[model samples]
Target: MPQKMVEKIEEIAEGSDDGLCDVIFHLKSQDLTLTHVVNAGGVAFRNRSLVTSATELLPPSLEVLRERQPRTIRRKTDRDAEEPSFASTIARAPISASPLEETIARNYDRLATAIASAALRPSVERVKDRTKDRFRQYRPAVLWSSESLRVALRRDDLLDLRQRTDFLASLNDVYPNQQVGVPRYFSPARSSAKVQGELSRVAWGVERVGAPAAWGAFGHRGAGVRVAVLDTGVDASHPDLKGKIKGWAEFDGSGAQLPRSRPHDTDRHGTHVCGTIAGGGHSGQFVGVAPEAEIYAGLVLNGRKGGTVAQILAGLDWAIEQRVHVINLSLGGRTLERVVRSPFHRSLFHAASIGISVVAAAGNDGSQTSGTPGNDFFALAVGAVDVKDRCAGFSGGGTHLITESEHIGPKLLPLAYSKPDLCAPGVDIRSTVPKEAWGFLSGTSMATPHVAGAVALLRSACQGFSDLPGFRQSSVIQDIILATTFDLGERGLDHRFGFGRVDALRAIDAASGWVTDTSEYRDRRNRSPVAPPSARGRLGRLPGIGPADPGA
Candidate 1:
């Protein structure tokens, strides 16, 4: 709805006639409370909010989230050439929301409810967590986010206080309202076949993503890169992962960092992920995507108890500080609403800004959208595909809501931005387990490591890819990966296949001085000047990798 805005003169020249001000604005559109005002008492602007209710009038929807998007026009220049014109000079309709407003609008409902509920809670600690040890289960919690916003939510109002956006300026973090969990890869446990050479020889996932072909041609297996796996700790002593664990840390159930913690794997998940990433493949066991990538394992998840959002955040912060080439988070949280922006959204954005590739799993809930973090647009979210290129039934897929802020939505199949960035093999995959053994497990979790390992390989093969300005580096690598995929389910980028099942050889070919080929991905990524001189005249040269191209 168009608001009834009352314009106020914000600034006036010294003793100007009739107190003239250039721009007029309204401090508050609702309640007309003018708590935050401009040009008041000789002050340029003053924010004095005595707001009785901080709640926005309505919840944001995908339909209205684009209100703040600026309009652009092609204007004729001196040489009759067209140049893009900004909305400000072109007299287009004004964008309704600002970045601040967008965040507030999207989160107002949930926060309001949390605040209201908190006001009624008794000031007492609970005996147990809301879901007990089942951290993967979704529940309501209240967390404060960003410094400017203050939540009146009572300490006990929300169950997960740490997950809330912190009200104190000391901690400027966005938080979830519930405990988040690493995606569960629990299927029936593997039998002795996990130990014998039966299922251990060749990782089907590595082949599914075209890793072997890349190995044969490019001869790069992620030797010069570092990868951070935030999960249950890895078994450093496992033969296949004997020397893969480089840096190690553990987080308590409360998510506190134990900087000097020892490497441990109470459960098999992280070890399996490690094995799939850089396992030595001794004893005929199939090797991981990037077998030689250094691994930094953050023991965020507990063997007996599931993981928490705070632990994940701590581990991620550590990884980003380490500046590892890629960070893989094979976990997700079931969200309450379509317009949710969990706290990790900001964290993921930070990692991206610094040029780190943070890959996460599209949840296994099989819901309409993927969970938070993975759903975040900045993270390289992955979905699960089988050897046959079929989308897994348990693999999460749905439509994601896209907003003008460019914050990514879920990786579900229904909406535009909600689909997984890409798909990878996630079923019946074999990798090293406890006791120097091998095992089979499945989930978007399994699929996520494939992409993470591939990133290590890509970063090693193409130094130029990571050397770009931090923000552009990940995009270029993503473009390369997306550019040379084997489209499945749908022809182009879709909810199921994402960019498509990742093709390692094609990605290697593109990164290994082969981008000059005439493929869609290469053509799109081949920009001059923006790219280094070494990249000039190198794109769109080779024949495109088509559906039936040899070795495709």
Candidate 2:
């Protein structure tokens, strides 16, 4: 590569958004390495010549180098950085002098920024188009109305008509007379038997708190709670999951129609997650976190293995309108600066205000970092822990929470402070398979649904508490789960385990007003101790068995 050509390539790449460019040059030297960044538009590259392959290595190949380029630029003048004086002024005003009023004002300002950004971004439109397309193909039974149909339907006999064969036939071109089963799933006899066995054993009872044991003990079995699994579309017809799936929306630009059952396991990841959250245990094989919770499957990620932030937001918005009680997000990526002004986060906040609990998996990057939306405080960010209750090697950590200002610009960047609110079993967990089979997988993606299911259990058990008049509503359901976790990572709440490992039985007990002592809890990651013989046996029996036993 010539010096002049190198400088020219560098200039073009630097000037492009995200320091990327698409151009090819025949280098005079074979020792030069070419690096390129490629996107939908095309590819860009940079090359560096070296005396030997080992010295600096040839620049990446033109193809490889082009694929690495940034798709967009981060500018100081980016709209997200500008302060909203009017909204800020209104927010800071001493209106009513009440805490609630102040909170509302602050939220209003945040909402304003989010809305503005949504209006300006073309990504939002693309996401909407994709979502609408998917719905048109599968689950076409779902009607889209420009007006408030839920309200209008409430005043008419539309819901009643939905139960009528002729009306359904008129509305849907396929299987008009087919009856849709109730979304929730449960087995009183089976649950009672499992709960009794756990209660009879001390260690088992203690370890599985807020889990199936707790779920079985209380009759609040996720009766009315609706959970939105935002990932690949679910196998709505899987025998174990058939009636348990209530609704679905595809944001993959294919148009929504009846969910396909054949290629249910295309990704396999989402199906496994769905099983973990609501699998009916029909084969006496696997049971979900909240067996009776209604599930609304949203396919945000496509078969191609990746998706954008916009697609995720569209799924979230639809979930909110459906009044889903809990949202389980198991996918994430690097944080973008514009995310703070994202309508997606604002919608999540709106859902939170209305009692929706959002649970997301921290990235599997194996560092003290978090991805957007998951990084958002309103969403309960979860990390991965092994069966032995040790932090998974790939789980991300948190050092400090990023503020809105830091997330916006200038100094706006992801902070490496304390993160990952809590950890759960993320390594080698087995769950439902798309084609009526079962498989094991790993990642924080597997960890998130654990919390989602736990939330469903809490929702079921806390019906009375939530119904209580003026109970102070001090925290969201995510907070309750975090506060009740068994603190095990460090002196207090640190990055490894934000609050601590999730104990289903304990969380449920806490919801019912039963508190426990946490002084004896230890961080297995830092401690030099051996598990008791009995504990070792129990650990060995855990679902997923990894090669390296950290506890050992």
Candidate 3:
């Protein structure tokens, strides 16, 4: 190609249109390297299949996000080494303060608490309560005591960030007993490697998680309950995934639905994850964890062109609106982002509080690595396990824990579980692809759907589960899922195995009374990681994701 054409191509490729870099690179066995990337929550444009961020249904803040503004704009030297961290603030009504109080919560019952504490506070900036009006739609769902509140804020300028940081410094002295919120982000948890498995017997991943047993032995196949797969859009026309799609939609950066879900699957991530969750086994070559379950598919990622955090939050918000019983997020970005933001985390907690079980893939960033929403407190993070039940090399975990999650599980998990909530089959997993094809993929992404499908089956087996009190249904479901796991890795909740490999059969059996100890599933609200005394404004080195550049 001529030099002018090459420069023109570079310009267009580097320029993002509506959140997509739209790079068209031609490598005739000569080209070398390239790059670029992008997350979901919400229901706007009630009837329209797709809506933009500025759509009337979206909150004011989402409009800003839809523009895909830079994630942070700081001087090169000022930027800290990016590390993934985000804070989710879950609150109810305020309690009487005393020496006995271990932490302080922002607001008792208002959606504005998270924003005000971080940026709207009088001490932080002159912005004051003005910022809260922009994000009232992002409030938490309260079940037992009061509503939950989780918020995310943007620093429009150096002065804005300066005020926020200065306030963070005195957080210890300001509210000695309260927990400050953490900023959060969302990324895709890339896929796994392809390996050979028995084409005849049940798909190894399905068998490994005992999906067949949940079907044949108990006659449970995730009926009634609905599960959502938030990833690259699914190939709705695939034979196995045909009628399984109860509802599906695509979203742009700002959480608005797409015009309509495409029958094509340029990105097979969502299709494969859906197949693992509830493929109809049209080819008889692959089986899903919950074949009879209803599916709610969201195309958060746009094929190879990466998506943005706004896109993800919108999908999540929509799934909650759709009242999905379980949601599986098989995508994520780096586990090393500097500032850990948790608007995504708070949304997950809000979804869970409303009885929606969320499962996310631990990123592929290997051991001791963690990232965005997956590392958030509320998301049930799943790690990848090969057919041999060994943790996948790319599974991300082992850094820090959400203070709230530290007290979850039937038993107290070891601190190593700062990342992974558990493990499931992800290696060499065979499932439906686009154009009626079947393919094998591996990653924590694949492992996530297994758990999500399991959640559906357990919900199907349990009667009157929905009638349970707020947080009770999700808590019981979580308990059954965690306690039934077959132990592995370090004899306890190691970074890799978390609560150990998932046992779908055991979970359903205990949940449906095939086994005893139904009481083990009770909700234990012991630890409050949110609004805790020492929780700081979870800050990190903001990278190119912010203002200076619309993250490449």
Candidate 4:
């Protein structure tokens, strides 16, 4: 590359970092020698995955169990199981009120110094002596995968590393970590018309989507299905969430897992999202779309700064490890132009490839504003609608042009997917909040959980759907939902409303019919090739799919 071009690329990349100089490097090889060169330059690296085999090289203080663990490690049911000291230390540490960026920086500094003193020592210092000595203190934040590494490096050192032929040959790409946050928007105050009795017990959004109807007809309220809520965290003590939280963990801004994490919300956003997904109707309020579903809550965001791309990815990796059936990301972040290949996109693709239904919030910026992960082709980006089934004013919609990553996922298809796969009730949505309270929120964030919960219901109702090949399960479910939706805005798939507002009863009926018969199947990109008619249509009622409930 020309010097001017390298300078331009570096300048563009500089704007994306959170002032921590944190950048992720995807190398062509998992060889430690490539990393050793960087490490010897006084750069301390924290391994999230790659260090497993290097356990013997780790200091005695690490105390890693020598026993080889399976790649698909099951969630430890016994809380007493031994954990890494780093996790336990964090578990015992007090929650700091410091700025997230500053806190993360401090943690990295401490960790780097510790590793230098304990692990690196004389050998690393001797190697550093032979170098040009341009490098100073650098921190190891996280090792995302065997080939991907995240670290805090000085600008000059980063430039130097890029110029090295040895390093450059092994490096696939390097980019600053992006910031992520809840895609929530505030709505204007509306008239407080009080409702009493049964009508007020169940949320209007829940009823509008016909969740109760689907539950009664299919006899499945997402039973035996697992949904991962990657957000602030769920309030486990909430009445509606009792007996619903099956697993819980927290991730730092660097995407490292916090030790001994328990169920607790740093903000009400996560609690509300979780409630809408699987909260039991214990408080006489049927707030959740799938009341019987189990939750695997990962606290990826907290306080004002929210979180970073690394944190969300860590939470996502944790969710995938748990073998959850569905994932709800009620959050998003800007996709920078400088990014040639997005780690988040690849992660979503990996999740979808394994049959997990990933639902995300279409950003709240309105019009042609779409956020990443949601904008990614694999994610089922959900838009927002009001009680009257009108698209929310702040609902984001746009067409994602395939510019950088033309080939994505196992299929190697050009994933030039559009925004808002479907819409769901979001305006004035009432659900459980922290401190045992119920409140109303309006955003695409709120709508996302509705779709996620619906996916859970579909998974439970249509058992063995996982037997479908990679990505087929989620694609089929998305197809059923899109086909059964009540069309709004444009005639077919449009920006405002991708298909239309989700109709749970109709979707479940269609899924039930398809799974029972399995005679007709379609494979296409962007939209379903043909919409499956309603129960009363020409196809009539299949053996399992019955007539739509008159009460719905």
Model 2 is weakest, by summed lDDT over 10 consecutive residues, at: 32-41
lDDT of 1 by residue, 168-252 (tens): 1123222322345556775655433432333234566775676655655555779978899998899899887888789998876
Name the candidate that leads on TM-score.
4
lDDT of 1 at 227: 94
- Model 4 spans > 4 angstroms off: 1-9, 12-20, 27-147, 169-172, 187-198, 335-341, 406-416, 519-552
> Could you arrange the candidates by lDDT from highest to lowest?
4, 1, 3, 2
- Given candidate 4, what's the lDDT at residue 421? 69
Compose the digit string of candidate 2's lDDT tens values, residues 429-484: 65676777655566788788888888888877776435311111212244356545
Give the number of the best model, judged by lDDT: 4
Each prediction's TM-score versus the true structure: 0.64, 0.55, 0.60, 0.71
Model 3 C-alpha lDDT per residue in residues 1-552, reported as the tens digit of each score: 233333433444334333222111111111010000001010000111121111111111112212322232123232211111110001110111211111112223232443355443432233224446633322222211112222222223212433344333322111000111111112234423223423343567876676665565566678888898787778888889888888877865434466855645557777888899998556665468888898888877777665655567667767877878998888776557433434465456546556788898888878977656677656788988886688878888875632222113322232222558679988777788788877777788888899998888888876656654334356446655765677777654567877678877667655554123223322211211111121111101112111111110
Q: How high is the CA lDDT of each candidate model? A: 0.55, 0.48, 0.54, 0.62
TM-score of 1: 0.64
How many clashes does the backbone of model 1 have? 30
lDDT of 3 at 460: 83
TM-score of candidate 2 to 2 decimals: 0.55
- Superpose all Cα atoms of candidate 2 onto the true structure and report the RMSD in Å to 1 decimal: 19.7
